[model samples]
Target chain A: MLEGLLVDLVPYGKAFQDLDHRWMNSEASFWSSGGERHFMSEAMVAARHAQWAEERERTGGGSGVGFGVQTKDGKPLGYFGINWLAPAHRLAMLGAKIGEPEYWGGGYGTDALLLLLDYTFDWLDVRKAWLMTTSMNARVMRQMEKVGFRLEVRQRQSALADGVWYDWLAYGLLRDEWAGRATLVEQLGLRERAAALGSGAK
Target chain B: MIEGTLVDLVPFEDDFATYLETWMNEEAWFRAHLWERREPHTEHDVKKFIERMEKDERGALIGFQAKSGDPIGALIFDHEWPRVRKAEARFFAGDSRYEGCDEVLDALLMLVRYCFETRNLHRLDAVALPFDEAKLDHLRRAGFVHEGTLRRHIRWDGDYVDMEMFGLLESEWPGYAAKVAELGLQPSGLEPKPKPEKKDEKKDGTG
Candidate 1:
């Protein structure tokens, strides 16, 4: 498990897989889909997980890697991972979700993202990390900026959500640009939370 | 086959496959066309590629031939269709002579028309490498808006290069068509031209 101040990137065990349906169908799904709300059956989620596992095995995890985000007490908050990786270019597209609504705006996703980036740049040896989100997602837009990712592209009116058209924004961060987790945690004012969580674990 | 003034969108055949084998081995042509790492493809690999294109349900690969019936290049449209109305358009000119020419734009206009009109797609997306100035010009002339650039996204030769993204919506097509029309590029008359079977029959009879 990859450790973080607020969350740890854990393996997707049976328990986490059991909540896949709920998380995918929840309000978080809207953000994940870039504004499209859709329902997914347990069977469908199972099939998707199976496909991801098969793909990981086939590519020897060179393509992508996913992880379950959990708290110190071992409570799963959501999931995050690199959606795609281009080894030749040393670049990866990242994705994450704090499925539990109570965790929203609480920095859980931020900590998880920082942890994921650590894994991506340090372990994976990727040069750049990027992701795409809809313009309507203000939280993500703000988080990406706070995390030091540059808004590289804006595809205007590319996504339609709830009868309204929103631009699809792509954000990219280079390895050298990332101020490591400790600095970022301090920069985002998450040091207190990190401290509190660190003390609580003792 | 969708016929235009200078080029026709033909189905994938052995002749086009042969042309692709030659183009795939050309370093400049292959690098300009795709982001995949440069590696020589064998005849067997080319055959497998054609088979994959034929079997792919979510994409269409069509070759464009000059009025002289010479296979110049191919265009590909990939999408999930009804599930996701947006499609990605990729095209390359195997014959350098047609690069950024009227014939290339003609083929693009035909493709845009087919995607928005016949296929009823909502949007079309395309990408071009940084050094592909001719392709960038063609995309702009074909009415694709420059969306954004992904920095150092593509591996070219041994170094990384930027990838430019372009998109066009269905609602924007009419305006673009009119603009191109004023420039004297006719996007009309996309009816499939009937093939001259006599030529094929004579060839088969003689050979």
Candidate 2:
């Protein structure tokens, strides 16, 4: 579990299923421009939930962890997690989506991201985290940069979304780069937790 | 088999496992070129790898000497994106003599022609470490444009190394092909262009 100022990231559970299904089905969710906006059948959503739930039980705290991003009052907002976790190389891929349209543009998303990065870098001992988004997503691109991710590549015309060709932007953040921004990271209220982890945490 | 002047790229066969094992087991080459850990090589391991590649439907070929028929290198096309008609290429030269020679270029040209002209791929991508100037130069000479840097992308010898990404689009091949021919790098048997005669003139009245 990871607690933040506005959100808490918890392991996948039965409680997150409804929100997950809605998020996956909604056209306004984060994956809208990626051509996955169509509503999935209830059975398909349930099956997906079951698969992820089993995965959480197996590797949640070990290799990879999927979290349900919720409010302090336990109001579910979305889901996020690190997939393709390569602990051997201290690397992982970041994936997240805030399904609740009401929470759009709210600081909750950024807070959730900060909390996730804190866990990934400090506790998970991961040295690198990367994410990819289509060039059309200016908002997410700006948010990623604001949180210290560096633009690594603009894979030209890689994604064809909505009959339009869009470049896929790959962004990566290294542990040392994250460590150097101590003052900024501290402002996220993760300093105490990160310090408690100590140097050997890596 | 795609035949070139110096080498022919034959579809990888089960019988070539011994040659591949010998190539991969070269400690110096693997240390300098590859990112993964060097493991003990055996015929069984090579056989399993061949089977896996076959099962995955990967494009793999063994470059053999046209004269001696000895395996000189391997060319692999991986990370296929059928929807986008693109793939990543990995080329390893087993013979050190071919490292900085025209034979390497011949093999590369053949592969590029096959990929873009025959297979009709939209793009091909390759990567090299930042310090691998030789390979980077080879990529440029073969008409691959620098894409971007993958920062601290791979662990090499216990330290992270930045990888330089390069890409070649099929649309750019005609221009590159023209440049190669104009530079006389094109293989023999293709009719060479007649060289323009130099006009000699007196600059300071000394003919």
Candidate 3:
């Protein structure tokens, strides 16, 4: 498990799987799916999990890796991970979501992202990490910029949400450009939580 | 077959599989045309790929035949998501002689027409490696706008290279078509009709 100031990245077990339908069908879906509407049944979520397991087994866990996000006290919040990893290029695409609305803007997502980035750059040794989001996802745009990710591409009118078109934005961060988890915690004002979590936090 | 002034977009046939065998083995061409890592493909592998492409409903693989009846290259339209009315376009000239030539431009224009007009797709996306200037120029000339660059997107010979992304929307086609007509690059059959002298006479009489 990867530790963070306010949350821990742990195996996405059955508990998280049970929550998939609710999270995927809620407003949280828009953030993760780039504004595409999704209606995932429990059975569909199970099938998706089976597919992910088969893929992970076939690729020996190299193609993609994901984890559930939970508070240090064991309360589930959301999940995030490397959506795709290309070892040949040492690059990976990262995705995350704070499924619980109450946790929104509380820095839980940021701490989870920092943990994922730490795992990606330090553990996986990826040279670059990137992601794609729509311009309508203001939270993600601010989160990406705050984490020092550069806005690399903006495909105009590429996505539609609520009958309006939005630009598809791609953000990239190099391994060398990452400020490390500790620095980010301090920069993002999560240091108070880090202190409460004790010495090895952040 | 979609016929153009300089080339015809023909359907893929067993004969085209041989070109794939050769092109897939050409390291430089393969690197420039595709994003995946390079691996040697046998004749059987190439045949399997052709059969799959033939049966695939998601997209199309079209061959380019020059006016002289020689297979010069191929145009690929794949990654099609019909629900969203979008697809990706890629092409390569197996015959080096036709690379960056006017015939290639003719082929591209035909592709654009087919995608936006015939297929009625909403958008077409394209990508080019950093070293592929001819393709970059061709995409721009064919009405695709440079959307953004994916930094260190592909690995090339122990180094990483950027890939430039381009997009063309259906609404933008008329402007590009006008530009093509203004530049006299449209095929003879598709060219804008010349103004009639009778119309000029009628206007003069009205005045």
Question: Cα-based RMSD of the predictions, in order?
Answer: 4.6, 13.1, 11.6
Off by over 4 Å in 1: A195-202, B27-33, B175-180, B185-207
Which pairs of residues collide in candidate 2? none
The sequence of per-residue lDDT tens digits that candidate 3 reaches over residues A56-173 is: 8887885788899998788888889998888778889988877899988877889899989999998988999999989998888999999999998888777877777788899999
Point out where model 2 deviates above 4 Å: A17-22, A25-63, A179-202, B27-38, B58-68, B175-183, B186-207
> Interface RMSD of every candidate?
1.7, 1.6, 1.2
Candidate 3 similarity to native, TM-score: 0.89
Local distance difference test, candidate 1? 0.80
* Cα lDDT of model 2 by residue, A8-72, tens digit: 78976778776666777775553533543456788998897677667767865545677888877
Chain A of candidate 3 compared with the true chain A, TM-score: 0.93
Comparison by TM-score, 1 against 2, better one: 1
Task: Give the alpha carbon lDDT tens digit for every residue of B24-142 in model 1.
Answer: 67753564456566778887888897898899888888898877787777888876445447888888877766666777777787788778878888889888887788888888887
- Candidate 3 segments whose C-alpha is farther than 4 A from its true place: A193-202, B27-33, B175-180, B183-207
lDDT, each prediction: 0.80, 0.69, 0.80
Greater-TM-score candidate between 2 and 3: 3
Q: For chain B alone, what TM-score does every candidate structure achieve against the true structure?
A: 0.83, 0.77, 0.83
Put down candidate 3 lDDT per residue, B155-200, tens digits, no spaces.
8887888889999888888743564575465322223223223323
Top candidate (DockQ): 1
